[model samples]
Target: MRGNTLSYGTRYLGRIQGIALLVGGAMLVGGCARLRPTADGELLGDDAVVAHARLLQMADTRAMDTLLVRQALAASTPSVRAAAALAIGQVSGRTLNHLARSLLADGDSAVAANAAYSLGLLRDTASVPALTGALGGRQSVAVEAAWALGQIGAPSRAAIEDALSKAALPEPVLASLLLATAKLRPVPVAQLIPFLRHSNAEIRWSAAYPVSRTLAPAGVRAMLDAARDESAPVRALAARALGRSATGDSLAAEALGALDTLARDSSAHVRINAVRSLASYGSAATTAVVALTADRDANVRIATAQILGTVLPPQRSVWISAWNADTAFMYRRSLLVSAVRAGAMLPALSPASADGWASHADWRYRAAAAEAGGSARSSSALLENALPHVGDADGRVRLAAYTAFATYADSSRFAWRNQILVPALNDPDFYVRATVLQALGSRASAAETPGILASYQRALADSLNDARIAAVRYLAAAWKRDSTNFPDSVRAMVQALKPSDDPLVRAEALESSIFSSWIAAPPGRRRLDWYQRKVRSVLLPALAGRPLSATIQTERGAMTVELFSIDAPLTVDNFASLARAGYYRNVQFHRVVPNFVAQDGDPRGDGNGGPGYAIRDELNRRRYGRGAVGMALSGPDTGGSQYFITHSPQPHLDGGYTVFGRILDGFEVLDALVQGDRILQVRIR
Candidate 1:
């Protein structure tokens, strides 16, 4: 991940010679006084300086050019000679091939090591001696030698065999070799088996994933044995390996038993891994996972609950009735998590079980239930168990409760959920407050977004960009929910009225407003269906009638956007009319979900605010989300002037409502409008 090459100017000037020995070789250590700059005497320097500069210029293509080889081999400085050798190997020809072989004798390890890399890159068979020598010289020397040898293919077979034969190869080196070999050959499993008990944790851990992909009967048993090891990391890795392994009659009991022990492992991480792995076992390990859904650790319980949420049949009860029979205090929290994941309302646990979790003082369990049980529909019974517990002393639990509400807020079926969000706005945790804004962003109507909007407006200036970015996502979601163009127009009006400090914010404003709108109102399943959607156009005094300048920037150039008033007559007329009025000006492009498009256009400089009014559903065929420029809406066809661009396919918004036009070029620039990046301004060309 680190930069792979040194900058050329520094690399060239940094290598000055310091002293000359009687043997004609120069010792270049900078501290040597004998070679220090002199005031009076001229050393043999002019010719050498000219030659060095010439060599520096020649270095780029010297490997392919044969004329430089003899001079490069005879160069006074090892560095220059090394540079030339490196280039020599880069080219394909007979004469330069000999020069690459000659570089093995170079004294400088840096030069020789590079030459080894070049040899490997060249895959020249004769460089075997050089690579083998590099293996013993230094670890980097050896490691690169090994990598290159492997890259060299079978040319260095004897050296590779000899290196493998040595029992003393250090674990890191072996690990590197194993990692490298795993890339090259299927024998990585066989080669790594002997090193399983090796003293390196990294080697064992890295080996686990690859081994899981290539399981042998013996390897499976070894991994199973490792699952019971005292080391939690080892146990976790072994569990993952086993989960991916194919189970036959011989391994079935062992596999299930390992999962059982792992689900109950004292380590939280191991338990979480077990929850995921157990799910991979499907129904074979369902009973164990069910028991695990009751694990004492909140993480394990949550993971079990969440995994079962998806893996369990949709609408089929994920919760079983038998979990209520568990009388143990610890068992209740975990069991209820399982029950809730099964889509059942809160299970009828014994009152004693709830009191024990509430009384034990850990407090997170109570919070965990509120957070994890978010999937479980709230009822009078659930509220009886959950509402009083929200008053728990632990601040963490209270925070979880607030965050969980956001997950629940969007469900119309859970209309009573806002009872949770309104109160949580003031919670101490910024995390909880953030989550509330997000939920409200999705579920909040324009009226409902007022409080969250003010909060986001204040927080956007805070140093943390994540809060701002999140606020943008929610605000975008909120605006889309309120389908009227006016909610979005209010945003454009503010931007049009704003002071231009970051012209960048203007780009974001345009992007966010446009993106959220597209997400809100995608094209109808049939293009004609989108035409049926309607919104009342408020005629702006400035816009008697003019074309909208709908160009989005990409790296190559900008693409023009045209709203179709004839096709989606109402949406087109309204947005084009707004564009003609100079409604969009210095707005911030507030939301840019990476690999997704940039969003802008909340008047508050937050993403939540949208024009007031909801429209009917206009389902269309155009896909929404990435690079899409479509109308924003409330519910179905409640489209407004606010529109958006998408960077990827958002099937979720398809067949929702009107899509007018897409960016024809400039997608690269659209990709560049990153979070915290400003929109310069969106104007007619």
Candidate 2:
């Protein structure tokens, strides 16, 4: 999922102020202001500038030096203090929470906001009292503190309620607080109901988001009213809330009627959410759901296909008809996977048809055929359908076949299971090998098979980093299953890789090794001199005055995006450098979820590949709105070449992902993209 470590390089900077800029016939609204320089009129000296850059570099490298952070926090300059507060949060250990909390009352709003954000990042439960007290402070600080409380989750609910009970909160603060409520479990639906009717569209939409997340029956009436709100986002979330809350309740019929109307709403985003909600009514909503399968929007059709099996019976004629009629591979694949998930007999595909698909020239169809085996009625049928393709010429097909076998087949009943699986350890594809290793490790028979053991032994020396990581996981799983019988060689291998050059491999090895006590230790700082130099020489200079923009050329059209270089310089530099090096050329948008995101930058065409190295996340104050570009990560600090652009406002993703850019033009082009769409090239400006 991650990549190997490499020596660092320097980059440059740019900043955006809250202003509207006309770019190529489109209006681009930059919501965030540029990071302020020192208050003094005197230009920052060279040493001072480098020192400031070093603080950011320390955060980038996750250097956990409390003393340095404390010194920076005590700086007279608001910018330095603000940077230190952000760094403390980015480093993300609880060691500096006290010092960070002390900055909550700083004279500068930016300093206080950054401190609250850091406290939230640390997830320090002890800071709740202090954070809650700031909920009524400056509007900006209150918003950040509320978000931080939400990040801390349910423990801060009473404090949030206490603030809400107060006389009058500003619209911005109230809207932020309402959105934060979405993150807490057992959402305060009663408190949220009144806000749904708020005159301000922003507040109404914010209230709708929490109700959508909780789906509490009590909010059904208010949500129903919100469904007709002028704002598409409010209507979209309200539709979801109605479907989830109205199920098996007195409001079911009324809710169903509202969903049907909303399903035809002008906004594709509203329609996508409405279609998903319609699934809750079962057969009662089938006709409406089936009608959407023919919708002109590919994403809407994809959404309809996804839930068709849930709404319609397994024997419905519509499944086969849709599969045959839909020409798009993504839609057809969605239909098959949905049908299989619902345990459909899949009578649509006869033996000859199945065989034809398996032999199809396109590997995607072949992979789908392999995946369809999960729908088989019996073990024999499952094995008969999936086992033959384990050695398919296409690695994706082989990967799909192994995945099906792993999920459905009773490998223990088949005497030749090891024969089929052991050889896959040598599969040229690292992902396939990793999947096979996972499959083998999961089976009880792996411990008794000499070939399987030998395969694990050989995988330790594999060239690919992911395969070696998988081998370490297999060793850990094997050890856990039968520690008494665990081989010394495997244990030794795990120990030997603990200091691996690859950060992921080392992290994995450290996690798997017998030295469990050492796992709690903080991660060692990787302050590579080359990386620091690059941050100072390349990244810092690039951010001077001018803003950076990237034009991504896809078959649909070209979309120009303005980079948030000042807020997320590291991420922007990585993307720009990668673009210049041709890493994204010809790469497919491997993942596209309706009304959510279109993700790309994976070389393997699967969602798993990266640029062969990982980059540190530069999480900033940027919010995810329509056309926002953010990094994709499997977990914290694992971001690499992959990134995605939001199709609509996704409030839940705020503060969770590194958002580095926003679309400046070609919104229509973004809306037109679908799965497997190719990036023709990326031009940096």
- What are the candidates' C-alpha RMSDs? 24.2, 8.0
| Candidate 2 lowest-lDDT run of ten | 7-16
Estimate TM-scores for all models.
0.38, 0.87
lDDT, candidate 1, 219-277, per-residue tens: 68777877877667667667666763455568867887887888888776577667777
* 490: Cα error in model 1, Å: 2.3
What is the clash count for each candidate, in the order shown?
Answer: 67, 9
Model 1 regions lying over 4 Å from their true place: 1-137, 140-170, 177-205, 213-236, 244-251, 257-336, 339-369, 375-398, 408-429, 440-452, 458-469, 476-489, 492-685
CA shift at 421, candidate 2, in angstroms?
3.8
- CA lDDT, every model vs. true structure: 0.49, 0.71
What is the per-residue lDDT of model 2 for residues 175-236, given as tens digits with 9 covering 90 to 100?
A: 77888887788889998888777789898888787787765677777778878999998888
